[model samples]
Target chain A: MNPKNHTPLIFTLLGGLILLFIVSPLLGMFLATTPAQLFETSKDPEVVKSIWLTLWVSFAATMIFAIGAIPLSYFLARTKFRFKGIINGIVDLPIVIPHSAAGIAILGFVSRDSVLGKIGSSLGLNFVGHPAGIAIAMAFVSIPFLINAARDGFENVPVRLEKAALNLGASPIRVFFTISLPLAWKNVLSGLIMMFARGLSEFGAVIIIAYHPMITPILIFERFGAFGLKYARPVSVVFIVVCLVFFVLLRSLAKERKSHDA
Target chain B: MMLKLNNISIKLGDFQLKNIDLELERGDYYVLLGKSGVGKTVLLEIIAGLIKLDSGKIILNNIDITHEKIQKRKVGIVFQDYSVFPHLSVKQNIAYPLKGKKLTHQQIESLIHEYAELTNITHLLNRGTQKLSGGELQRVALARMLVTKPECLLLDEPLASLDVQLKGDLRNLLRKINQKGTTILHVTHDYEEAIALSNKVAVMHDGEIIQKGFTKEVFQKPANEFVANFTGIKNFFFAEFSPINIARINGKIEIHVSNHDQIKNGKIIIRGEEIIISENHIDSSATNNFKGKIIQIIPYFSNFELIVDIGIEISVVISEDSLFKFKFKENSEAWVSFKSSAIKIIP
Candidate 1:
């Protein structure tokens, strides 16, 4: 064999180690559990409700906050305002900060005595131990993913395209919608998917805000802490499978749209 | 409509536009000619309402549009790179500006088709702009701008990105567009393109309008040394002027200087194309004749530049047929004649 052929072999061996590193834990957990255990966990109403709550709250948070987050992202991408670097750093702050600290921060703001809590109380609503609180926690932690990705997308949109649209007598708002947004759709889509996925996986913040609604991660933690790994492992296997299915489905749909566009 | 810019001034980064005053009559094609980074595009953008001016007045068709929003200003601009929207099909891109207008869907569709045909992009109407070639993208961008029927059209180096053949075609298209009575402002660094497409020309240097007049006047009689050099007036000599029309060049050649006003010493500029080359000495009404040897023969587009050593080196542009007729080459002896009227004295 040619000496160059060894390069591919060496790289493949090195890359396969990472692929196995990612795949091994899940595979081992899946193989360790019997089908009967997985079925039983799936049948448990609390587990079913917890997983459903996780998916539903994550999706709601992504859809609801995207309306505001995407526009903020476009503003960040398009202009260099005073303190722009600081504002961009603030956008990424949630990712670097400890999740428990982030949870504590949210707890202080939406707690019963905080300004938002008072407003919520006046409206006969509460953020503590409620699904609304859970949604807020999920959105707070995951919105950075959407904003940063969408900002990158908007930055990639050529400024000349917007200028050309303006010269053609189209208003600025119309140019944003018809030219910038459509061109940056792929980045926007990926950001939304990431936000949805990150929101679904949030545990520390949601556990702090609302413990009773029991999003799937909190449930898994509870099962492991109280009843040990035997009960928690089966639920974990089922939840992971469900998430993988949805992620794959969403990604495939995005890929289909991309190919269709091309 | 006639457009006038009075006292336009702005400072952007290292470039500054200082008190630029220019006017364009209705239906005139004016080229803003300058070197790169000389604020040519900035001037065009200011006129198009893309760039806000610090202090200026823009009067178009008797209406002051100094502070008008870009969309309300009846001006269209074709950018240098032809920024066509990549996600939209050519037809959709051209029809984008017509959405808010009172036109019906059929009217918009018909207008798109009309401009698509006019710009020779009818075949590419259904294709996304990303899939089109460079020339195709340029035509689509032009059609998109023209479909709105803007009152004043601004082109920023529209032909710079094209091959020579495509540049010629687009030039003809621009001419046809100008003939339909739209006031056009074109910015280009290429003087050939400027001279080819302009009735009036404005030369900018370091963000100021150095000279502005009819194309013939600006090219024939440059206002200063920069204009002379920029317009390719290659023959320049330091000379002293005595009483009457006599002037001595390099203390060697003496010639009759026309139109000497004041000051005794200045630069004399002679355009290369005005210098007549001949085989032998010939008597004529010309003021200066020199017998010199060819130092260099540079072949340019459709012409040859003979740099002749006449005390000082003087470049003369001549046709290829004349090169063969005189058998001109390096070290070939030739006679050069130019009138005093052709010697534009800059003091």
Candidate 2:
């Protein structure tokens, strides 16, 4: 080997340690849970319901917000207007703010006396102390991942492609849907997956928003606080396993779609 | 006129175009020839309504389209990178513009098939654009653009990234496209491409149109030194011309000119092919003849390019037959002559 390749042994060792530091805890947690305990936790009605609710509601939130977020990202990517930086900063503000603070901030706007709360009540829906509240909290905290990813994807798409579409006599709206959206579909899908995953893992925000109808994270905290470490271990392991399965499934779907599109 | 740009001016980033005016009659092949960064692509974009112009009036077929939207302008553009939609198959991409035009499915398919056959991309109809070579991509882009039947076509270096053989093929393809009644405005930096593919040509430099005219006229009598140099004329001198049309070059060589209506000490140009070479001085009607030693002889394709020292280095092109007859080599003396009409003043 060359001397240049020989000089960086320390860097590789340190990097390997960091990688181990991230992987060891997950591996240990998975190893600690017995199969019987995992089966018992999975059979519990409350735990199963909470896990199902968490996955579906987070998926629902991601799907709902993407309708607006994807278009907003495409607009941000393609246009140059005044205060664009300010708009970008506003998009990123949710990620930077503490999640608990984000939860509290959302509560102020959706409480019973607020305008959104009154509108929801008028329509026989309540945002506070409801699953809708949990969905909102999860979406609020995780949407920046979707927006930033989609924006970057749009930026990578060549402007000439869009121009070529317009030159072909397609309207601006048609160009966005057919050309821009499809070209950036992989990034948008990845963003959706990230947002969905982030929403699934939300704790500080979702717990504060709707603690009564518990998500998996809140259920894990409640079981640990009330019972003991053994009771929460199997639930945590099961949730991680479920999340891992869905994450891998979605990622492979994205890869498959990308190859098909290509 | 099919398309006319009246006093178009635009400033994009650091490049500025000032008072660019051009006109194209119906079925004309116009080439915008310039070096890179001379705003050729920007001008094409402006005419296509892709870029907003600061001050201009575009009249296409006697209708003002200066402020029209790109799609509504009835103009199409093919980019240098082809810009074929990667997410769609070739057939889908070709039929993209006809989607909402209320055409029947059969009509769209037949039209796609027709254009595909026209551009010789019929075999690649179902293939993904990502798997295409540069030439195939260019043909697909042409098929997509031509399928719309736009009034005018703007090509921004469409053949720039292709190989020489592919360029020759696309050149014939563009001619065929033009023959079918589409006015073409092709932008390139190549002199030979301009001369070969266009009947009319415009030369741009530093964001301004330096000269625009018939291609043969522009090549023979460039309006300025830049145009002359851009048109591949290599022999140049900054000489002083007297009132009687005698030019003294480099404070040494004096040559008689046909026109000296202006001041002295300006630039003059002559093409290398215009210079005649002989071993001995003979009577000729040409105005200027100089006896010079050959400094270098470089073989250029089927001809030999001799760089001779006539006080200053002057390039002269000679055929293989003439080279064999003259038997001129490095350090050999020869007489070079050029007509007065061949000398062009950069005014």
Candidate 3:
């Protein structure tokens, strides 16, 4: 029986290998930065401002995803639509497309000449070299995480609940808010958490649009390019720490939302 | 009270509802009876305003609500699966419709309690509905639907998923609801259920209502062969017209018929379970008696249905008590007798 546990043994080996692969870089970042240098860099105002900007921008993007992405995801989940398979494929396109390509596509549309950008500019909003640019970049790469997550959550919900509400003389919209949203809230929350975390780590796209906003990822890149990995190491370690806390919280939430077999 | 559907036609995939016309008066418990994929549930949904009909007019209470949205229609529906919300507890689920109304928490609670006690699931008020058994969930679902007190209620096979034993109790509960002027449009495919509960039955096949009338009338005198076959009327045959009312099976054999109501394009129905069989001809004045050979004896619980050949194979069902009393073996000669009233004309 002990020897027969090869499946679990194989699983353990695979998990251990993946953990090493993810943790080794963070370990190297910490090793590259001495304690004095890490403490010295942490005192800098530029570092603090960049961290706050990254945190707040990610939070704003997550809120936006919650407002817009949730309804779309729920619609995709609940309805038997003609283009549902295609719609889902399109939502997932951002995840698979090269992040640089995604950055270029978003840049082309929000470049003040396109209809959407023109409207935004008329409303005294500009995407170029502003927080809006970083927001758009983060949104482009990370909204798929939120939509797919919320969609999966809505899909997990039993549609009978919606029907029950309607048959009880409640309106369709009433049923959606009262039953569907609350039931699938945890899934959406996890999506938001992941999208926020993904937004925090975004670098490739943000560089194309708003490098001066100096999101934490850009700061990490700038420091490494100008000074060395030694200077960049401390910032990388700090970003890693902030992201780890959120990652743990997301994992816990996912666990909480999972159905127990009973 | 007056619910009328005028020429309702809807195409859903291959099964299309050609033109269904039905009316349910106040205090009428109408059950839509049909086989699978006959558009019975779809019809219920259309009436409830859940599904938009391709073309039709649904006039409820003299209101032309053909274009009304689902919420504005004010009709309640209990889907075939009961479709209870798993997230909301019984109390909350029952209170779902009451929300956004002028009712307070206490008022909602009282309504929930009132409907809950009526459905006899008051003890399940606080439990998550996902854990409920099919019967309990159905009661909660019913309680929720009744709490709203919509103009008309549509039920789609509330007993289909329950075990055979539970159907009787659920059916009786449903009958009591029907008795209270709910004007239920119940949908079911089961024949016995329609016989047991329906004041009016609309027979649907391949998405069209072939026959609709008083329950017993439709069962006793089917309008067509399809309906006759549907309602378990087993003794069906066609014979050419004769000068006398004797349907001649052969040169020497003929069966007597007197009821002209039993003639329709020269086709008639005799229920398999209604005909009686005996070894020697009985002295009773049963209108039709014929000498026949038993082709098969099919056992059905406490009785056996015997198929006999008197030129044409005619089935006669006999009780097991009669099976023992008459010592007739299979392939033996027997005389089959039935009354004229038992024969029904099928258009």
Candidate 4:
């Protein structure tokens, strides 16, 4: 090997940049609040309720995405059809739009002036200031991550495998469950984690949709406005910790899946 | 015949399987010979009911199974990739088709053991099927098919991905599979495989089975120019019967034609096997002998494919021993021979 080979230097530079970019803000968040302060804020009754609502709604939204998007993603990946490009573009539109813009668009559908909102109110159910609103907002912006990841996973499955399964006396549905789904499960799982994380951090969309019953992000925002950074930083620290733990567990799972596949 | 196809047709975006008619006798091996993109695999899938026909009927044991679902069709498929389930063990993969059946666990286990033994992969039962080599994977795949006891096995380039030694071994394995009362509809673009494995061969071109017959009939008399060329028939050139049978370009050589069955307005064919490469025109034994210079010398396994540049480039295949003895090489002078009877004068 050449002593002057540039690979290690290049890799070190890239690795250092990514480490600094991700770690610095997270470190700041952690350092901003002491463990004593984090524990003290956990006793705030309002803060506890908002965080509970946020986690549950985000979890529900993520579960719904898993249930619906996996099959539909496989379809988009495997099918050869006219207007597939248009359909794919439509699926990815939420990701391309800013979260605030996505919220504004959702507002157009569920505002009191809109037909759906009128029908909802007539039925004695309201999207505004409800868990349903939070779920919808989380789902709208984050659904594409799960769908696209799952789609790419399904795409990597050779069509010949399906044909082989069919030839081996399995139906099309049987083939999907047995071969296609299992092979693509890792990518789908990673997508689910990413989508869940995306949903957890959804501030712009959820705030615009349902501002009163403040989610964790909205609570942090409210705390900052009402009680200043001293009150908000502790909750932010706890929220970051929860998000970090969830992600770390998921990251390990994803890593295990990658190694298993390899 | 266990399976018979009548004018089966299916069209993918660019490729079409047009008017393919085939008959597969009980335990018969029929190889679909074609170029890479000539819809050979598509036709096999259509027959297996994985692909719906544009306009056709597939008859299996006299039941019109044109609209049958793939699982209901009882066709086993081994793709070029073998398509073994990566997650499933060898036993599980082989025993996959038996999952929803009425067979007991022990029965399925014993069946897997039996087929595994037949394919000589019994030792790999607990290992994942993906860990097996190409030949091993194919054997397992074939064994998986065998357990289902399919009406016919559809193999698309079964040994195309294997090494030369493995391909030969797998070919033998495939031959053994065909012997075990299973009909095979094997597809390959390789002429040697088609010749070796198939009792009947279908030469496809541009999505159509242009010529199909018993292996010898199709090889001896290809129906058209495309089939002739595709199968290494090595026969070509313009000729007329009225002019005492002279090739269009070679005025120095003359040939006699009985013209028993003249086809109208087409180039005549002289099969490579029929063309004889000799040292000289020793007159007393054979006719249609002529002097020529070798243009190309291609070693074709058991023989040498000597191209005689007699104005029209007549390619003659001779034994390797003869090539070594005479040293008939590239750009060397040589004598060529063929009987007028062997000159397939296209009518």
Instruction: Give the DockQ (2 decimals) of all models.
Output: 0.75, 0.81, 0.47, 0.59
True contacts kept of 3: 0.64
Model 1: lDDT of residue A55: 96
lDDT of 3 at B244: 45
- lDDT of candidate 4 over B1-347, digit per residue (tens): 68999988776788777788889999899989998988988887788777788997899999988998777887777777777888888888998999988899999989999899988898888887656888888888888888998888889998788887788778888899899878999999899898889899989889887888899899887887777777877767656455544434344445665566543235677878777777777664456778889988887546778888875678788888888998887887888877777877655
Candidate order by decreasing TM-score: 2, 1, 3, 4
The global Cα lDDT (0 to 1) of model 4 is 0.84
Give the winner by DockQ.
Answer: 2
Chain B TM-score (model 1 vs. true structure): 0.87
Candidate 2 residue lDDT tens string, B140-182: 9999999999899999898888887888889999999999999
The interface RMSD value for candidate 2 stands at 0.9
Q: Please tell me which model should have the higher DockQ, number 3 or number 4.
A: 4
lDDT of 1 by residue, A35-58 (tens): 999999999999999999999989
**Candidate number achieving the greatest TM-score relative to the actual structure:** 2
| Between candidates 2 and 4, the lDDT winner | 2
Better of 1 and 2 by TM-score: 2
lDDT of 2 by residue, A1-262 (tens): 7778865897899999999999998899889989999898889999999999999999999999999999899999989999999999999999899999998999988888889999999999888778889889999999999999999999999998898899899998999999988888889999999999999999988877799799999999999999988888899999999999999999999999887765
TM-scores for chain B, in order? Answer: 0.87, 0.83, 0.82, 0.85
